[model samples]
Target: MPDVLFAATLTNRATRLDAVLATMDGTMLRRGHEIYPAPFGPDAFVAAFVRLARGLLRSEAREGVHIAGAALALEAVLDAGAGKVVAMPMAADWGAFPLSERLTTASGATSGVAIVSLTDAALLGEMTLGAGRGVTNAVLLDLSRSVSAAFCYEGKLLQRPYLGAIGHIPVPGATWRCACGGHGHLETVASAQSLVRWMIGRLVEAPATEAAVMRLTGGRAEALTAPQIWQMACEGDPVAAELMGAANDALAHVILTLLLALDPERVILSGALAQCGPTWRDALARAIIQIAPPARAGELAACLALGELGPAATIKGALALARQRVISITG
Candidate 1:
């Protein structure tokens, strides 16, 4: 039987599960996938995983199952009786010992459990198969509801707990508040959700710009999303353009901070915001170069790039982690 690789990624907005059937030689066969809105808590997350896993199983023989998620999701899978599990933490906050203990208690389980960080997985995937391919040093920034970054050096990922919470760091002069009760966080200005909120606020202040975004969202300001804002900006709406520029400036600040601190050879942008395309890229690049130290401006300008894996990046990274586990076992 071909090796079956199951991977799941949970962000604040959604959860995605994907399975690929591959031969021992690493050739992919059938692939199946599913997505759901993110659950509320640990119990809800566990229930969702069980339901998704059951539907995916479809009477296939039990092999190893690889899961990538936050702490609760991994615990849920272990409690649900998946055999020979490999759990990867999608965020730095999750615990490994508790999940490992749960896996150890499962009956008839001969396979061992391994805990890996999703940061490592993402770096590995990028270096091996995605945009950062052949690069020695780089950073992958996931720009979703919350921002997280992974560092890669000498083709290996360096997992750091502080890196996962970089988005929570306060940005100077930011007026919005974060969910964590912090003011001026990068997430308050740079995240897709924050951008949506900022756009809504802009509509309230500038009633004239309301027509375009209201038309885009079908007459509801609350329904306006970051992509819609970008669309409006593309269409030359002054309000949308200003909001996009401000958001991009905030993001550029974050990127500039990372570049100066890490000095990586490449910086890869990923997640929903990155999907806004070249308009967003151009704005971010412009901001980076405008503020970059003149001596290193040319070098920094060449370092920014988009993630090649797109929305599938985290899942692909999880799959790569699973593949590595299989290799280590069979080698």
Candidate 2:
């Protein structure tokens, strides 16, 4: 029996799902947008569950499935009838894992940055499965559960766990707060939402109407349609261009800050915004050039490369995990 894992992705806004899939190893299989709920249903609630069961059964091997990100999706996969679920939940104590899982070997030429890919919900989910692979000397963070909490580790296991949450949610002053009552988080500042909020703010007093805003940025409804903003910038809109520049600059600063704290060899970025286009990439390089110190920049080469994982990093990572079951039982 080959161990196979199943993961699902419901995010189909402002991005192409295939982008995230670029990072997966050949062993994993990922499928997305296969289920559509009622138009008014909005959430992927019902269909997501259906897909989970189907994917699990579809796998030739009897690998256990693990649902990630939204609890609803997880619930749906569970309801659909998965044999086992392997979730590295933010709420779980990750310190129990073996040492190799905690230790990570950063990829690329950068000797000072970790080439990590991040998505909306489960920050470390993809890294643990994909990039982080089987490294044991590592830490998995999710601010959604607790802002002040993180899973610390020794050589290959949890050493002393404490509050060290990472990932995004809640803007400092934005009314969109987190379920934990905290306003502003790594999600708020760096997420695609950050760009969306910026575009809405630039709207010419149109009540932030979707129709009007869509017209403003070419009819996109994603929380942060950076591409639309990029287009506006390209079309010579000073305000739009400024926001685009600032957003990259801001994100670069954040990365710089992370470099000081964590000594990863390379920082691999996996998101729609990271690959808006050549112009967006250029602007990001410029921003990093200006804000980051020359020495730090030289001493460390943390690149902002686009992740091949597409939009299904989480799911592929999960399914890849399921495949592990096949090897375990057979080997």
Candidate 3:
């Protein structure tokens, strides 16, 4: 019988939880979204997970469609051994919580509950069904409001020493303070927020580009956004281009570090920044090649690619993780 599982994404930034019910082979049975309570915490998170899963199951209208596993792709680092949330940036209330255990108990999930970082889940999703398909070793970098990474080697996800939390990797010239209270980290300039911040700070230095950007953003620096900056860079705005070039260089440094450390077959870029269109993507690819060691530059050039799953990548990754949890238990 095909394995029925429930998977969801619960990020610190969003109020609503997005979930799906599907089989092991990727047949979607039902999907739903649930809002977190006024004060979201561990209990509320567990309740929301159960509520969403049960709601999806009820919508199936099929008696005896037992869910064999459940998983959550969370925007937090979990303890590799105990499945406890060890660190959740910007979500302190959930820190040091045994989320997987609580979720399993509250939801009565049979196989066991898997709580994985959103980055790791995305890596699994891409490897299983997206751009990383057929690749045994890969690194997935999620460059959205923040930057995080995950690594897979020889078809297994590495969970020790928390390799996925690469946001704080120090770049050579990035002295901007990161949200983690650190300076010069990769997230300081490689993330969407960082890119916008960098562009805004440099707007005054480039008068022509500044005027154009003011016109583009209605003369409000506070209202500036990353996509607008990327669009301007694509259109040859000097300031935006320079800001983007810095970001590209920072990302290249991180990617090169991962390539050297993990020796992965591919490096997949995902999240909002990856959607900045082909020009930005190609430029980033070129930046990576330029910084990579000469002999491996050609090989690494072909390895960098955009994730194919888009917004659904994390959800697909959750399901893939849930399947693994189930198999481990059943076998």
Candidate 4:
């Protein structure tokens, strides 16, 4: 029998679950790996978890299951009879353990649950095996539909009650409304959602003429996405290029703040927007360098770079958390 690890990420857009079988020595088994979507909401999340766990748990020895997700979603999983679960919130103020305990008591489960944060998990993965490897001081910026950051110093992740909440920070001169009811947040101007929204607005006001973006989206504004906009920018579409440049400028403001505050050795970008590749990176770098004070421009220019783990970074971080828990239990 082999020890199996189940890890999941529940966010605003979707939930992702991964199961990996590993030997006692921490070597991953070549087979029995799975990935699938678990939609948002308590019922949907729990159902997805139970369905996956039943199929994966069959005839295999269980090591432990660790779930990284939004606070509410983790509570739903614990309520779904995920015995002896551990909950890691994506942010510090995200409450998970109290809700887990209430659900556990109601369900009469004696098993205890522990709580941490997804930022902690991501930092662990980066420091040990990903982009932050061998770096003593660095920052990992997870830029997606939302942005979050984690800090590492002296080769250890700083376990602060609160970490990066860059998404909600207001961007100067930005007019877009954030989902959090704030105006001009960095997320409002730079997130994938914001990019799509800005693109659609541009399309709407484009002189009543069909643009390349309209053609790319097949004349359906609702179907436009951030990746498509990046593709258009890459293909030299002027509107797309302009939109992307604006987004990069908005992102630069946030990065500039982080650099001035932390001055880490490196700032690694990860998530969907970061996947836009060198075009996006270069644009952002140019903006950062331009806006940085002349004295710091040379140094800041060298600090910004893309993450090495690609799309699997967060899930890999979850796996890292599971491995740590397994080791702590059996050490």
lDDT (Cα, tens digit) per residue for candidate 3, span 29-108: 88898775543677888888888888888887777776889888877667856879887655678778988899888888
Q: Rank the candidates by lDDT, best first.
A: 3, 1, 4, 2
All candidates' TM-scores? 0.77, 0.52, 0.91, 0.73
Candidate 3: stretches off by over 4 Å: 1-3, 12-14, 37-39, 204-207, 214-225
What is the RMSD of candidate 4?
6.1
lDDT of 4 by residue, 261-293 (tens): 888888888777877877778778889989999
Q: List model 2 lDDT by residue over 59-178, tens digit each.
A: 434454322211111211111112222223331322132211111111111111111112322223444544344433333322111222122233222222222334443333444454
Error of 3 at 226 (Å): 3.4
lDDT of 2 at 11: 35
lDDT of 4: 0.60
For model 3, the local distance difference test gives 0.83
Can you list the residue pairs that collide in candidate 4? none
Candidate that scores best on TM-score: 3
- Give RMSD (Å) of candidate 2 vs. truth: 11.0
Q: How does candidate 3 fare on TM-score?
A: 0.91
lDDT of 1 at 46: 44
Winning model by lDDT: 3
2 versus 4: better TM-score goes to? 4
> What's the distance in Å from true for residue 22, model 2?
16
Rank order by TM-score, top first?
Answer: 3, 1, 4, 2
